[model samples]
Target: MKKIGIYLSFAALLLTVGCSDWTQMEPVDQQPVRPSEQNPELWAQYTAALRAYKAGSHTLVVASFENGSTNPRVRRTACAAFPTRWTPYR
Candidate 1:
C-alpha cells in the first residue's frame, strides 16, 4: 500500500509538471506583412539604396526614389516604407 502511494504521488507530480497551457502562453501574431516581399517597386528601391551606399554617394540614395520628389516628407515616408533595408544616417 505504501509503495502504491509513492508511485501515485510521483505520477501526480509528473502529470502536474508535464502539462502546460501553451495555448494561453503562445505569442501573438502582430507583425505586418512585408511590402518588399510582395511589391517589385519597393524591392527595387531597396536595391538602389544598397547600390547608392556601396557607390559612396549617400545623397544619391534618396535620389533613387521613383516618385521624383526631393521633399523631406516624401523622403521620410520612403525611409519608413522600407525599414528592413534602409537605416537613417546621422
Candidate 2:
C-alpha cells in the first residue's frame, strides 16, 4: 500500500540521521563551585551587605501599602508607639 511505503521511507530516513557522534561533547562537572574561589573580598562584602540589610537597617527600608488607604489615626498611633524607630514618609 502507499501508506506502507511512506512509513518505510520515514523509518529509513530516521535511522540514517539518528547515528550522530555526540562523544566529542564536553562532560559537565558534578561539583559545586564556591563564590570565594572566584573572588574572596567581593564575596565577603556581598555577605556583609546582605547581613546589614537583613537586620532592619535604614539602608533598606520596607514600606507597607497593601491595604486600601492608609488611615491617619493608625499611622499616628504607630508613630506614637515607636517614635525613635519610626520615620514618617511624605
Candidate 3:
C-alpha cells in the first residue's frame, strides 16, 4: 500500500511539472529605437529642463523648457508641472 502511494505521488508530481502551457506565453514587445533617436530636440529640451530643476534653479528652469515647440502635448505636460515643481519661489 505504501509503495502504491509513492508511485501515485511520483506520477502526480511528474504530470504537474510536465503539463505547463508554454504556448500561451507571449514574447516581449521591444521598442525599435529610443525616443531621443527620433526626436533629439525634444529630448534635449527635457534633459536640460530636468537638470536646471535639480540644480535648484526653479525660476530659470521654466524658461529653458519653453522651446517654442508646436506640440500641444509638450506644452500641456510642462504647464501641469509648474504647480507642483515650484515651492513659493523662496
Instruction: Compose the digit string of candidate 2's lDDT tens values, residues 1-90.
Output: 999999999999987778655545778989877898889999999999989878864665689635444564565444345556658888
Tens-digit per-residue lDDT, 1-90, candidate 3? 999999999999988888777546878999799878989999999999889888884554343555355555654555555676657767
- Ten residues in a row with the worst lDDT in model 3? 58-67
lDDT of each: 0.74, 0.74, 0.76
Which residues of candidate 1, in runs, are more than 4 Å off? 1-36, 57-90
lDDT top scorer: 3
lDDT of 2: 0.74
Per-model root-mean-square deviation over C-alphas? 17.4, 14.4, 17.6
lDDT of 1: 0.74
How high is each candidate's TM-score? 0.29, 0.37, 0.30
Flag clash pairs in model 2.
none
Candidate 1 has a TM-score of 0.29
- Which 10 consecutive positions of candidate 1 have the poorest summed lDDT? 57-66
Best-first order by TM-score = 2, 3, 1
lDDT of 1 by residue, 1-90 (tens): 999999999999988877855435777789786867689898999999889888894444345546445554654566456667757888
What's the distance in Å from true for residue 7, model 1? 10
**Stretches of candidate 3 exceeding 4 Å from the true structure:** 1-31, 57-90
